[model samples]
Target: MNGAVQAGYAPPTGPDRPAPGRRWLRWLLAATVAWAVLLAVLTWVSVRDDPPTVREQRNLAEAGPVVDRAVGELLAAAGDGGAARLVPDALRRGCRITPFADGATLTRGVEVLLADDDVRGLLQRVADRLPAEWRAGVRVTGEGPVLRADAGEFVAVQGRSAGPGRVRLTADTGCRPIGAGYRAPTAGGGSEAETATELLRRFGGAEGPVQVSAAPCPDGTTARTATAVSAPSRPDRPSLPGTLSQFSDGALHVSATDELYAYRSSSTVVAERADGRVRLTVSTVCRR
Candidate 1:
């Protein structure tokens, strides 16, 4: 070894070609495990931080019974048979009361069998009494009346007569932070039918003049009916039902009784074959 060291070079005594392929494989396995751990951590964080959807927050299943109880209590307090009976019917028609950070909203389809005056009276009573019972604040603004209460913070209530008998009641009852403002989900404005439905839900009846007609039924009964239409003010523009449009193409058909009592209302979509034009129609119908 001393002679070799003193010479030009020493002979190979140990394996020094390169590290085994297994060493690189082991490093790769370790790196892969680290990457997987990082991904799992990131996924966990995302899931934990993500917020719930509006529908989830509403939790109809959990809130339905609560709302039912509240409404029942209110009805019991009112002792008004007309209002008491109608609320249950409205609830059965997929009506719901969903809570938010500031308050809760109540929505229901309306098809009342009672007189219009009675329905209006009942609604007024509800608007008047609910806030008092909940100890909520009431504020009448340009948009309409609003009710506010303290759930976790300040909650509010706002709603309207969706249609002739349909009602939409909103209350602020959420715990989360509110941004700009809260706007409840409404029907989309895609087709004439959709627009008509939304118009009825928003305003209940058409603002234009309604047409009346009568036809004899096969059962020897007279069928009295009322119809109304809303059309685009200009040919280039589209029209919506209710008082918003001028062309008078939006149309509605309802029973004469409904027209008289103002109990039931509807929205319809009509398509003209000649020009392939679509329009919305809103109508009110009376029940037998």
Candidate 2:
């Protein structure tokens, strides 16, 4: 047979070729799949459930008993003045049950917080038994100080124990509330003149003594000696015009040419008047 015919008739065998690109592509795909699976697992783990409100409620419920017991102890210690301490806590916490019985009062939850679980349930029970307004008016006698506030007004009972003595209490009428607390004058017993002076200092720009010059006499009229009048230690603007004769009406009447001025020093007033002129005066009640 011819060579060409013989080669054509015989089956030819080919050499093997390496598939490196296909192998690399398979490895890359597997690594990508593994990374994707890891990310999905991490996301699931990070987003686990945590309910803050529910937890807070639970804590209150648990601490209810402890708080309730504390209230009882506080009331017993307070005796007649127990109501004072309870008022501030009730106002702050938003929940309290004050019950009146046998002419004596009992405080249940003035400071109860949601963080305690036991107290929360007790408070809820108290709420269910009492009317809503009762919570606002729960008064435990002698528990609070006069400075403790209620609603928008700051109620202070000055001279509650003054009997016949004079004591002064000041409420910063001009001061507005900041956050949960009011910007009232610091609590302490002082004469009304002193309190007024402090309020004026805070309200008005004037501080220290206000000095005044005496009228000068003509050269032939025997020139009067020059005199300096020290400002009144405490001055308050009164609801009504003060009596010109009396220095303190719990108020002061300032004039364009008046020699007297008022100021405050340590919740008290020190009045210094020009000789032959009336000295400043005021009245006050002592705190019981």
Candidate 3:
């Protein structure tokens, strides 16, 4: 080990080669990471949309009963008055309050959907399907069990403001006792039909043409129903007064009789006193 300056060159003490397979390992590691990221991205993209599938379509097709039951259940969630009280927003939206059709299968989009109890799609969708009269130009506001309706006149129900859409028609309809409760004179089963007949007989002074049909009761029964007798207006004919009353409780009562006819639904009642001279036409529902 001479101390003389070793400027010529230095001897290599350690191995001059790089780590064995080091580059290959790094390349393999990089490839693995890239593959992992790509897999993760692909997986995310695959699940992002999750659109309805063939199985879902088939399930929807087979889900007719399910959809029907769901709609029924949701509709049934309403109270005794009718669907209006049960689901006002839904009723206002587009939900058509109709007699539950027998044997009709419901589809999600094709028929109906229950949606969710918390979500409003059920009501929105139903509202979308309603006739123009129900949703016709009306502004609605507020919340909860009570609703309000204001158009030409201010109408409030339960406690909420009833929008213009709610004022045009009714949803909840139940049968009420009319005239003196009479025992059945005939042997036929006591029903809405019998009630309608008894009402006509008891209040027989009706001079105008009267029409009757089976009315669907709120309790899921159908009976004889009557509407105003209509005739073509003649130049000499006197215009009859139309009697209609509304109640905050969502009831309407109308009455038209030779002497007097009264009709009531929810909270409204209309009475027409004919006194045997003036022909009064009243429309209403009576319990069997």
Tell me, by TM-score, which candidate is best: 1
Task: Give lDDT tens digits, candidate 1, residues 1-288.
Answer: 555455676555466554567678989999999999999998788658855444324343344333333333333322221211112111122223334234333332212222243444544554565535466444556745433332211233333444454344433333322223233222222233334444443233343554332222223332222333434233443323223333233322221221221212232222111122222242221121
Off by over 4 Å in 3: 1-138, 141-167, 170-204, 208-210, 215-220, 228-271, 274-288
Q: Residue 196 lDDT in model 1?
A: 46
Worst 10 residues of 3 by lDDT: 106-115
166-264: candidate 2 lDDT, tens digit per residue? 111111112111123322112233244343344343223234543221111111111011112223333552211132324335532222124433321
Tell me the tens digit of each residue's lDDT in model 3 across 1-288.
586656787654457755657768989999999999999998787668654233222221233223222222223222112212111111111222244311211111111111123223233433433333333222243452222221111111112223321311222211111223212112123343333333333234334544432223334432232333223333443322222221113442222333333333421122223323332222222221
Could you give the C-alpha RMSD of every candidate to the true structure, in order shown? 16.6, 23.5, 18.2
Worst 10 residues of 2 by lDDT: 216-225
Tell me the deviation in Å of residue 121 in model 1: 8.2
lDDT of each: 0.35, 0.27, 0.29
lDDT of 2 at 206: 32
TM-score of each: 0.26, 0.15, 0.22
Q: What ranges in model 1 sit over 4 Å off?
A: 1-60, 74-128, 131-133, 147-159, 163-288
Compared with the true structure, the alpha-carbon lDDT of candidate 1 equals 0.35
The TM-score between candidate 1 and the true structure equals 0.26
Cα deviation in Å at residue 191, candidate 3?
Answer: 4.6
